[model samples]
Target: MPGGVGYLLQHCGAFFIRRVWGDDLLYNSIMKEYIEILLLRGHNIEAFTEGTRSRIGKLLQPKFGIMKIILEAVLSGRVKDCMIVPMSIGYDRVIETGSYVNELLGVPKEKESLYQLLSNMNILSLKWGRIDISFNKAFSLKEYIGAHTTRRGIPLNPSTSKIDRDLLLQSLGYRILSDINKVSVIMPTALVGTILLTLRGRGVGHDELVRKIEWLKKGIEMRGGSAADFGGKSTGWVVDRAIQVLKDLIGQRTDLLEPVYYPVKRFELSYYRNQVIHLFINEAILSCALYATVKQGGPIHVQRVKINPDLERDCSFVSKLLKSEFIYGPNGLTENMMKSIEDLTSLDVMRIDVENGTDGEVKYLSLSAEERRIGRETFDFFCFLLWPFLETYWLAAISCFALIPQTLPPIEPTWVDERVFLDKAQFLGKTLYYEGDLSYFEAVNKETLKNGFQRLKEMGVILFRKVKKGNENVTMVALSLDWCPKTALPKPPKCSKTGKGSEEVKSNNTIFTSIFGGGKPEPKISLDGTDTPQDYFDETWRYFVPEGKLWELCEQIGRYRREGKNRRDTATVAARVLSLASVTGALLTESDGTGWIKKKTSKL
Candidate 1:
């Protein structure tokens, strides 16, 4: 905040909190006193539990600093009972969508300033559709604590110990967030974005888009979630309105609707989709579990399928894998899976059977002929809701392997800067997408990659260490000491300058020359250049260089340019080499009059 915003906030009884407070005994004391005084004086205090707005449109984990201060004030008898209200606000069109997309694509967020704020004021003229706001019923903080601890037969009181107080704070934080999520209004834009992003291919029929939107709305409502009501407007009208409002991202082509700038614009749409993603997380987990079971040779088919006893395990595994991406209920993974199963059963998409076994009654889940048909039809839709996240995790995992050295016995603890690791993961994601290996383009998101990295760290698959890089401390990621790949890692593709026969090169010489204009033959260097063996890059002089070798090539190019080589010819050759190698966004330029190839931060 800048200019009058800070002044206005202060005048409105808002107190600023420092993110980094060094030796803040006095600051903390004053803050605690001010909060307690406000509570005792019967002043309503509104605090954002998450501390800041989430760039991805989902609820971020709560920050406990202010919450801790407030709770201590109430629990220590400094203040009487206080009411906690969970508030959720949803937007049909976010004004900051472009900036959010930019940040997700690796661009650093711009600091707030008066000039920037004024320059962006033109957004007020845009038709942003509906802004749905919901505030859940307030609850007494003391009663909430008592209710939570009553079942454990250990009541939380003013004299509760530090451990109990901390535990209560943690639970209370999540409980408030869960309530906020529960009451979040699913705007039409959110529904439309979710459907469009989940659907395969670039184009969708107008009728088909509307149909899916309707189906998604019904499904969300069935899950006890509410979609924004447009005064009894028809589903088609809602679709049209959403399409109109999001026209910048989505284009209408006669009877077809397609994303305007695919892959890039998908990130923008994902921001809206993420708003309602939590409502579908359980179903997505169940869908993934079914797929995992099938991949493991379980009896699964279109007509009918018998659920394996390991279904629960599979669901828990999938949920744990996505634990960082979504918030799950406190009822535990198994309990959540059971609830999803019950929901599906109620919808007649599946059924359960109780049978007597040696260990008493056992329950088995199964899908009948008709139910299996319905399940199959809906399975892909549910899976689509989570496919982007899975793709992000998969890319993150592959980048870990990609970062490791290619050797007989792999490097023990290969480490890379966290920023570089994310960049590589995003680059590989785009490469895979262009090569048709990855389907979901939005998986190249930075936030999702960060979440995946966090989840991997939590799972002990990777370790994070801080190392000084220049003036700043950078986080370095490495494989955990105890972690081992289940299968042997693949060796890096070998490269050779003369590996491709001259005859083969001659055969494709015309096509290659036409694509990249023929230039004077370059003098051979002492560098060990290797030919790419992949069919995608079969042309001679083009190679698939690994990350380590890629940098060497950049240095080689720089050296050649320094030797007074033709700038156009040098850049042309470099571009062709990197393009075939699938590093599309890299730019070869003269930085400070020194020829250097630098990669520009971009999304796929």
Candidate 2:
């Protein structure tokens, strides 16, 4: 709602105006009218590039729908070329982070309501850290288009279905994300989270933890990124404040006179750490991989480990291996790796051989063995960040490849529902997590598996279909390749009773395959023995009459009181009900955020 003063001004006809929902962009009439009205009045327009708040902390890839509208307006001559300014706001603590975490864990976001609004007012009393705002210099769309003009004077139009226009948009999107990361606020809580998470929840001694924080702070600053205040305070003092911030602001306990993770708060810790991971991720990847390569036998590293990376070749190889794990720009892995290598060189983390070439090939120095022995913790932290992703990808690849036909079958199934594929992926993911093959942040993350599927899809390693299944159309993802032996791909070695050195070596060699590169049981059985969670959700849903809120109403049905029942248990029940309702025709979630059982389709 508009403020009273603004309403009064509007009543007095200060200016002609109308509020338009983002949904209006979906219709051609609405888009034309909105564009015509804005152009007629020469009004400034604003839109969120990401469309919505990121469920995960990083800047999401910008939605092209709104961008398409503006591009169409310019191309159609409905509006003149305008200056597009990219603005980014970084918060030390996001107001909706709790909801975001839940959503990331598969819980649907609760619909906005007055009660929720009032409930959140308590946040006003909480101490959220600073907000940093950054505005990039405006660039003219006309100039951008003109630069890509052909000799015949034809301007670049996204509507033209040209490769050039697609490339331009991709570049623009990456540029915007890069700008947002540049202005990201590096709070003490974020730093502390990074250390604890990277160390795999291990405690660091007081002096060691303090030194790590200082080292990290200096690295972030050197890269032109901001860190929470460290000036005029002793190292110990800064460390104490960081610990307090973690406890008071985030409710994490890291002070045992040593920094350690609180098991219950690991997810929250990861969220904070992710905010700054991109800053040093590249260096971490390089240094970690190199360190692992050098300390081969004692640790019994993977066979693929390269003890000495040939500057250009091996850097590119490692970067490609890490593609699914990190966000990369349109310039792609090679260029990004080269830039990271240059940065590492500048930081004195590692040096390149400038004076002499090794037998007509490029050569560079790895960190000294002494340093690796001392900095073992630091490298492990970096490598661990990539561990979950690699493990999840490996699980998906192994599972999917196993499904492929080793011998010719009578018939090949064209597709499997996307959900079924994901269920299998999640089951395997959960198994790996339980076996300690995955990281804390990724243990229950089906989204990571989805990404792995997407990467495989993009590479033609897998295929999918949209088909009518009962009353609904479902997506079915399938492998494109025939089955092959485990030996052909990277596989973990068989476990032995003694667990010799080779066994340890084999254990460390994890595998990954990605298209994007980038659970529970019930004992309840009804008379028909078809009592799945979906059935329970369907039956219980009827008690709420016309519609029920999945979260609030389900809580009552399940008798989940906040006091005694764990939040995760309640959250899991709610998430599972919603998931079941979505898959079967049990319930339909409306735009108004209420769930109603579908007519004549209650049973599943």
The collision pairs in model 1 are: 495-530, 496-530, 496-531
Which parts of model 1 are misplaced by more than 4 Å?
1-4, 21-27, 153-162, 200-203, 255-264, 294-308, 351-368, 371-375, 402-415, 467-471, 484-491, 494-604
Q: Please, what is the TM-score per model?
A: 0.75, 0.67
Tens digits of per-residue lDDT, candidate 1, 297-319, equal: 34554322234456776676677
Q: Candidate 1 — what's its lDDT? A: 0.64
lDDT of 2 by residue, 1-604 (tens): 3356567766764543233343444565666676557755876767677777765565665666556666667766777777788787766666666666666555555777556667779879976656667776778876665664552265555557667566666655665567667766687767766776666333566676787888878878987788866567787786666566556333434545545434346665666777776777666556544543343435322312322444344445445544555555446555666676677556444445533455555445554344355654554655555544554554455445333332333145334446544554454444334433334445445555666677666655667766555676566565464322222211211112221222111111111112001112211211111122212233333333222221222222122111111123334343332333222211111111222221211111
User: Which residue ranges in model 2 land beyond 4 Å of their true spot?
Assistant: 1-26, 147-159, 228-242, 248-264, 288-295, 298-335, 342-348, 351-359, 362-365, 399-410, 441-443, 469-472, 482-604
Distance from true location, Cα of 32 in model 2, Å: 4.9
Task: Give Cα distance to truth, residue 340, candidate 2, Å.
Answer: 3.5
